[model samples]
Target chain A: MSETVIKFGILGCAEIARKVGRAIGLAPNATIVAVGSRSAEKAAKYAADNGFPPATRAYGSYDAVLDDPEVDAVYVPLPTSLHAKWAVLAAQKKKHLLLEKPVAVNAAEFDKIVEACVANGVQFMDGTMWMHHPRTAKMKEFVSDERAFGKITAMHTCFTFAADPDFLENDIRVKPDLDGLGALGDAGWYCIRSILWANDYELPKTVTALRGPVLNKAGVILSCGASLYWEEGKVATFHCSFVSHLTMDITAVGTKGTLHVHDFVIPFQESEASFSVASESGFDELVTGWVPKPAEHLVNTSLPQEVLMVKEFSSLVGAIKAKGSQPEMKWPIISKKTQLVIDAVKLSIERGFEPVEVVG
Target chain B: MSETVIKFGILGCAEIARKVGRAIGLAPNATIVAVGSRSAEKAAKYAADNGFPPATRAYGSYDAVLDDPEVDAVYVPLPTSLHAKWAVLAAQKKKHLLLEKPVAVNAAEFDKIVEACVANGVQFMDGTMWMHHPRTAKMKEFVSDERAFGKITAMHTCFTFAADPDFLENDIRVKPDLDGLGALGDAGWYCIRSILWANDYELPKTVTALRGPVLNKAGVILSCGASLYWEEGKVATFHCSFVSHLTMDITAVGTKGTLHVHDFVIPFQESEASFSVASESGFDELVTGWVPKPAEHLVNTSLPQEVLMVKEFSSLVGAIKAKGSQPEMKWPIISKKTQLVIDAVKLSIERGFEPVEVVG
Candidate 1:
């Protein structure tokens, strides 16, 4: 068998794509041989600077990138509003997909994309790098198997950052159609994804939301709160805000114990993350003078998103080549479940918190 | 004219009445002149045993106790379901009233009671004991006036306790018609009351609630969660449970710092409370550090609720004895607002959190 590398083409010169493109370029068995943009000159320039040969493709249109026979996979970093259209077009070309977070603006649109991918027999994976991380799998195993946190009673997740306009022009985050789901889609999805994955992808039985309007900006949500009925008796609440302080924290409370992660999504680059679990009896006895255990460095070393993402993608490509097919693993399952949850949250927001049922 | 102690009468031998009876017996310048119950023997026995002479009167029915000219005031500790009827009757007799907490089941009922009190030209007060405590007034002044906590943004209050069926048997708290408001009417009212009082009587612009049933217990709310919305994007979430492990705590987050009080509502009784404020740049620091404030110890000091009750009631009596035709400067304005907020919370619960427009 020939040791074949996955040839990759990326559409949209999005901020995220720049990092993902670099990742693909560095992947051991992957090559970003093509780049597309709205401007032909810009596309050609990007391809040239990024080591694409003159014979390699440089297209001014999105469809032109998908039309290239040498491109086995397409990385779609387009705005959320454009995610479904591009993913469908790429699937029509029978190319594997790595769509950006949220996958689509809403669940219905995401479903159509999923249907198209399945119909074309193409591999579809939503770009949720965190879920693909080894640490995430460890978290899931601890919560679900080890039962380190007992029967989950409540989970609180927060993701927030100050949005400075000048740096984010035409950013989908401020687009009503693309980002109307607001912080929930932008950052809250991670919390939702984390909770769902930890709970074996048990969809919320009921959901309610509270939304605040963005000030000093049009078509942006300032903050949002969501409550999820995860099971017959367990409930979870999540909050995200663009106008508040920066934070990414997830805490889970259960029958006999509690677990907390201070920074789950974007952990401090130099600071290791500390996790602590205390049982009911342990919590009581240790209250007087409880010394928290030293933090464990989950990542071998700090790396930029582009480097880490490329590392993971290269690993996946290698595994697929070795297996002669997709690795029978959790990534596909995690991505599908995460996108479905993202869609449900958008629906709940639109209906002013009317419960939305999630189905497979 | 000789200064004379005001005589007080109480109808019903409910546990609340027993508490009030002791208060009346020990309150300075007040007398537990008479007692009444459904049974004449029980009424006579209670009156005699509690130091009320036969000359002070004992009656089989509530009206008999009301008609005793020696009883200058009446304490109505009847079930909230029975509050309206007995309060109206007490008002008709021109007797000043000490109505138990949750003055009425709903706003309309509370309005009716207020109207009846006005028509009879008698003083009426809700027995929400917490608000009358000096510490409550001090705390409110610190939070809102001094801004001790600084721009309070969020408040989390939890009140949970195991119910004693022996004490609650046939109690209005367990009676559907009387305590139908559930936790919003019972202990939950205190949570809302505290927030409203602390926030200068600002009514919640929006609210969300989750209620769980108390198994096999009639008219009792086993657990409830309510999130309150305030102007300028502030929020307060409160939880009350009858089935959870006993816990009570209130935490307030503000721009300048945070304040936490454990066992809040009855901190004066069951626990000690401390407040800590962090100094932040560009904000005036008013309160800082964990200062151990004195806890109100009336409940266990054997000083009797009557002593404090009479002290407060005597102020109204003194105002009455003055040249003014009606008692003035007796009832704290905060009490009126607290009642209104309690009514709004009930309306929110019944109407499924529809925004209740509150009159200033």
Candidate 2:
């Protein structure tokens, strides 16, 4: 029972943080002990509503909470541009870190975050939360089981949404000073992650990228595409567009069969995921026989996002508890790889959609 | 009935011509009176098997068919490299000409074909047969009809399929000098056509394109993408890939609703052509509640490739008979516009996917 309890602190009041706040309440072992925001009123309001005790402090500045000894770990839901600075500060204070996706705008910032965590002897994990979902695990299982779809040959993935032009202005997404990579750094990150996970995160032989018509007001790339290669001949293509209506779809076509996924990027309440498998003969009749096998089982994941985060974070905490010092967390390896691939894509786009090799 | 009947002359035994042959047989007002091919053996054998008269002469070259007194109008099915050569020659001979799609590889070639037909005072039609399909007409009506889907916001289209690597040795599609634009030229032309039809043939202001990974034998792009703008306000995007494992889909999203047309590229006999329109409120619901209106009419079209071609060619002949050659036999202005757009796309790919303007 004692080991089941883990204290959590919120460093920012973001829309995503609201979801995480709810998850922490639902998580069996997690407690929201403190809340902070750039605005004191916002911090106090969120703290009171999220079930923190009256004694639980509300801080106007992020530094006060990171300095608080009562908080075991901190969730950094700040803008992508601010992630590196705050994540490093949290690590230096010896607080475990769960930083958000696109860990930093670019590789250099990511390295700073990783270095601070390593030097401070603190645990760090990138909030690449989608992987914590069971459906992701199930997708991998289905692909690897050759009995289901044999000899994987190719995969195509896309994620996009029509974003409001108002939402695009002055946002960190459009600010090149923050090393803005735009769509490729944001939604396209998931596409690359899915591809890498499908292939066991093998380093691609070469990566090629292209960016679509980017309206100045709407940020760089209303759409973007990338092609990746693997050993002994395997190819993957991905596209992300902000100009289209919302969509999330991933598909893998093998020699003997094909696998399809629908509503992949966004999670629905009851039916978030759907997949269909078609054999060669079945493919011949795809126009008629194609059916979306309901992924009802993958929906309403019993464990909330906070619970998954806390549990993974707790493992690092447990290591700290046993050794009297925090061990290196999994964020650096995973985040580093993600940033490297994204950097290569950005380079490729700059070089006129040329193929860029992914080194280190 | 006598007035309804029209005579047709086919210039070759192309794989596509076979489809046209069947369509001619099925059309109410069409008859194949004469057939010609460079190989007398093959042409003579084909004439004997089909219902063409035994006297239908087999020639050693294309010019002989142009010289045939019995030949009225002609269907030209030749290599991608030879379409312009034979088409211009037939037009000069004053034969009503139905030339295959991509009328010529570039805008200049298409212009030459048009000039030749005008000088000879004959009917000229590019065999972009899909325009003849009722479904295409229906799609245009649905998108343009405000009562149907409302104002169109965006359109996405794809047409790609892997081909045999050795296809290039005998296939002019592999040779750039033969006007081969690779995947972007071949199947991509269809995707562009679909978008052009949907958008009412609006000329794009700018086009940004990216060449996909190249294939082994063809050394041409196996995959490609483009982002285009008809105006500052309206935009369209498309993807074409020969390396893909065969997929063809088109979707149009509008202010009030969305329309999805699957298998837009290749509507095989087994393929189902269906579209779903979603209400504004109902669109928010992820599953079943979208209130899908069923579309049950099946065109039951001919499966052979030549079927659509023959139907279109016969229709052109019937128009000439009815209108007495008052510009009724020519391809629509949209055909020329489609070639112009595609030509700009090729330039975009060559310039590393830079945005290219389509000159008015």
Once all C-alphas are superposed, what RMSD does model 2 give against the true structure? 5.6
Chain A of model 2 scored by TM-score: 0.87
lDDT (C-alpha, whole model) for all candidates: 0.61, 0.66
Which residue pairs show backbone clashes in model 2? B19-B306, B19-B307, B20-B306
Instruction: Give per-model TM-scores.
Output: 0.61, 0.78
Best by TM-score: 2
Superposed Cα deviation of residue B17, candidate 2 (Å): 2.8
Model 2 per-residue lDDT tens digits across residues A93-209: 888787777788788888898899888877787776667666776767777777655565566676655556664665555565542667777777778877777766776877776
lDDT of 1: 0.61
Chain B TM-score, candidates in order:
0.81, 0.87
Tens-place lDDT digits, model 2, residues B125-167: 7666666665666667667777546566566676655454576
Estimate, for each residue in B203-251, the C-alpha lDDT of model 1 and write its tens digit: 7676666422232356355456666777665766666644332334455
